[model samples]
Target: MDITHRGPALPLAMMLALAACSEPLDFDLRGRMGGSVDTSQAALAAVADRPKPDDRGIISYPNYQVAVARRGDTLATLAGRVGLPAGEVARYNGIQTDDGLRAGEIIALPRRVSEPSPATGAAATGPIRPAASVDITTLASGAIDRAPATPATRTTTGTTAPAAQTGVEPVRHKVARGETAYTIARLYNVSPRSLADWNSLDKDFTLREGQFLLIPVVETAPANAVAVTTAPGTGSPTPQPPSASAPLPKDEPSPAAMAAAATEQKKEPVADIGQSQPAKSSAAMAMPVGGSIIREYSKGKNDGIDISAAAGTAVKAAAGGTVAAITENTDGVQIVVIRHPDDLLSIYTHVDGLKVKKGDAVSRGQTIGGVRAGSPSFLHFEVRKGFDSVDPMKYLQ
Candidate 1:
């Protein structure tokens, strides 16, 4: 055979050489695929190497916090909620005159760390002891003593036998280390003046630690009547008249019972008169009134103050009480009377609508009605000692 006839073997030789180059191409493809797989690992590793951001906001300072007052939240209630006394809260917030906190008002409550006791001279340490508990008891003495016989000639038919006046029992309190006269007075529901008077100390005097002081009790009574007897020869005993003395009825009501009965009666205003009675603090009378003073308390004509607002503006119960009366007078002014504890009554006049029905127990600063339309839109607030109207400003904040 000729050498030219060996072309098939030459072609086979060329195919073998191409197969050797394909092995290298296969290695390059495997490397590229491995490189692609390594890229995903690098991406995941890059994500894992990134830093995270802290989420906490600006840190707040110690002993400083904010409080939001909700609707119907009084200063007292707010203080109680925040573990503080109302007086301290008021003083801290620089609230001197008004306690009428508007809804959504933000109040600041400053925390104070307790200091070392001066007496002990110990270093300032440990948790602060809470204030001492104060118990308020009605200070009236119910004990009846012997009444000296009055002259028989000067007696009235309607007047019953006088009961001996009961002496007021003093409340005993132990002074704390940091206690002051004002603090004690506030805690005991007594006035600082009254507290001083009971202890016979100067108003500015400081109370010593472990000192014992007396707190005069608060009492509410009907009209205080003292018997004025004429001497034997003077004025003939005001013309003695022979009047039959009826035997004491077995079922007769006591003075308190009669007063309660009268309170239940719709017509008459209850009377609460006593000289030693402490007036309610203005801080305690924090009724909200969005109005101007149309008239102030006057000695003659207008006895109580008048607050002028738009018609239908709310008129709240000045203090806690029951709805005593709801009537329209000849002057076309609607009036609602609320009888409080201890025989006190508050009257609201010129109301357009009454929200509380008769005998409904309303709390202090409760909405009872609104001002009448076409009327002066004024609330004629009166504090009555029986039928006589006393000054409402004397007891308001």
Candidate 2:
């Protein structure tokens, strides 16, 4: 009877214990739910982490259009005309030898990347964009002509007048018994009037046999300036004379002093030497072993860098084009120049022997010569912008 009576009180006691534990247990349950929610949020974040696709299209770079090679063009000259380095032109076109360029042939140029389209949401990573189509139909075939001239100025009070027209500076020419003014003028691109004016001759003056006439240097006038004609009876036109008020000589020396002066005559200034032409691009047929650069381009006295190699090593053309000039300097070193269709030119100097001749068509990496024995077997390579020398490294691969 006593046990049955306690059952009702036991249930009440159990309810009191459960009520006391409910608050703490609810907090623990909430924490566990929060952790699961954080994990789910992390998984959603990972799904959204991938990079988006770029919308921009393929961009183009600046590229030169290949022009048909003309006769007598060299890589150096072509590069100069096209405003690129000869070496660079070679490298971009995969010209390992100079023989790749040939007259009437086409080649690829170093292209730049095009501007990125904003709507596409993509950007170009490399060079500037180039035109899709180049107008090679109007390719430049010759050297650029003289620039246009400027307006002439009128002399004001106290202002000095410009010099009178003169002929080109006197070049050493053997006096031929039958040579006349007209013949000489035509050969030198000088006008007959300019020659006559330079010699201070009358209109009817005749060239004397065995007499040397001083050629007056011709000054290039601005494009818009009118060419001045020579006055009749004036000896080769006189250059603008020096001002009369300039410094005077201290005194004339005696005969003995004069003799001393004669012994002490000043030496003539050295003429500017033109750069040697490179081997034709077609001559660049062979590849050098190991493909290590033997010479580097430089701006100092060397002009080009010399790559070290053994004598009798195979010498390859640096660009594609026609072999232009091949000659040995006073030092007995051989030099070659190659002209490209693009008007660029390359120069190879200090070679031992030349295998190509002037006017022979060549391609990139063609062999034009070999290193001579006993000579420092090195390639003196250069890149020319037209006739001007530039750093080859700027255009080299």
Clash number for each model: 0, 96
- As a whole number from 0 to 100, the lDDT of residue 7 in candidate 2 is 80
TM-score of 2: 0.32
Q: In model 2, where do residues sit more than 4 Å from their true spots?
A: 1-213, 222-300, 374-376
Report lDDT per candidate.
0.46, 0.42
Give the worst 10-residue stretch by lDDT in candidate 1: 135-144
Which one is best on lDDT?
A: 1
For model 1, give the RMSD to the true fold: 36.1
How would you encode candidate 2's per-residue C-alpha lDDT over 1-397 as one tens digit per residue?
3434778776576557646852211112221233322111111221111112122222222222232333455555545544566787666544442443334333333542233333434332222211110111101110100000112334567563332211112342333776766556545555445555544444454554543444433434333444568778775754432211112223222345333322322222112123233322222222321135644444433344455667767676554465555665434656666655433556666566576776565545556777655443455566555434566655553
- Pick out the ten consecutive residues of candidate 2 with the lowest summed lDDT: 139-148
